[model samples]
Target chain A: SQQGEEDPQALSIQEGENATMNCSYKTSINNLQWYRQNSGRGLVHLILIRSNEREKHSGRLRVTLDTSKKSSSLLITASRAADTASYFCATDARETSYDKVIFGPGTSLSVIP
Target chain B: DARVTQTPRHKVTEMGQEVTMRCQPILGHNTVFWYRQTMMQGLELLAYFRNRAPLDDSGMPKDRFSAEMPDATLATLKIQPSEPRDSAVYFCASGLVRTGRTEAFFGQGTRLTVV
Candidate 1:
């Protein structure tokens, strides 16, 4: 079963506009990570924010976690045409002696050049 | 930079044929994982191994699917008599487990089509 669900399933944006995607999960998580997938290719790790942390940034990516609300959002600042791809949020749930990470359906962002 | 690698980037087989996909994890990584992705199921973890020890395989189907890590470096997912419904992109990921951090790096994935 998927732990997280992403909103705004598809978004079209201008090259310089920022794109934001939201993810909601059902259970408590150890950490939440964002990933990017190019069409027909593998996924790339974007940023990982631990439970105790509220926000993190990497390059043009900004991720914020609101554990109180069981939600997180990924914000891409000054997006470019190359940044057009599918974004997914995966939640690492704390299980006994191990962890299970469940990925959401993902949000497809298309940037017009 | 170290990364995981998967073979047979694409495979098309008729239904009822055996299919095997292989993965090579990054050196010194102790954990490996296999996951399948489709338009409907999204990404599902089929199995995982820690130091070549099978940790969990509850998500895999018993009748036709099997996953094994024959050694520390190699892991394989085999499907006997695959069905059209099993067609999906199978991805292999590996990560280092140290302290309280677990970061997984994934391969390019094998796109399989069972017609």
Candidate 2:
């Protein structure tokens, strides 16, 4: 079983609109990270939020984590066509050793111009 | 600007044949990971090595799957007598493990097909 699971397996939106994707996990985690992948390419690290942090931001990307709910959300403001890609949430669980990260199925986002 | 490199971006082979994939981790990175991605299974971690030592391989099928890092710069994943179900994209990632923080850099991936 995967530690993290993203919602709305697929999403589509127009440029200039905001996109929000949610992720839920099954266990306690030390941190959660978000990654973006273009088709036929490797994943790009987007952001990371530690267990003690509630929110983080980087440019147009914002991530929020709620430990009590074991959930996190990624928000992209003013979407652009270049933002079209698959977004995955990876969790570093509290019990996991070696800092092993488990990935989720991912949400496919298509931003229209 | 260093990146993880994977060779043979694409591979096609028949069932029962052996397939091998290689990865070159980013310079100075100490941890390497091998993962397989399919439409159904998504990304599954097969094995990982830390500081050139095998740390975990519990997700790998011990019967036909093998992974090793012969040195600090190179890692390999091999499957003998490949099965149809083994057709998927294999990804190699490398990262530096530190207290309270870590980030993995992924390779372009190798797309393998078994006929």
- lDDT scores of the candidates, listed in order: 0.91, 0.94
Query: TM-scores for chain A, candidates in order?
Result: 0.97, 0.98
lDDT of 1 by residue, B1-115 (tens): 8989999899999999999999999999999889999998888989988999888898899899999999888999999989999999999999887655577889999999999
| DockQ of each model vs. true complex | 0.67, 0.80
Interface RMSD of each: 1.2, 0.8
* Candidate 1: stretches off by over 4 Å: none
Q: Per-residue CA lDDT of candidate 2, range B1-115, in tens?
A: 7999998899999999999999999999999999999999998989989999988998899999999999999999999989999999999999998896678899999999999
For model 1, how does the per-residue alpha-carbon lDDT over A23-83 read when each residue is reduced to its tens digit? 9998888889899999998889889899899999999999999999999999999999999
lDDT of 1 at A9: 95
Candidate 1 chain B least-lDDT 10 residues: B95-104
Per-residue alpha-carbon lDDT of model 2 for A65-102, expressed as tens digits?
99999999999999999999999999977887768788
Off by over 4 Å in 2: none
Pairs in clash, predicted candidate 2? none
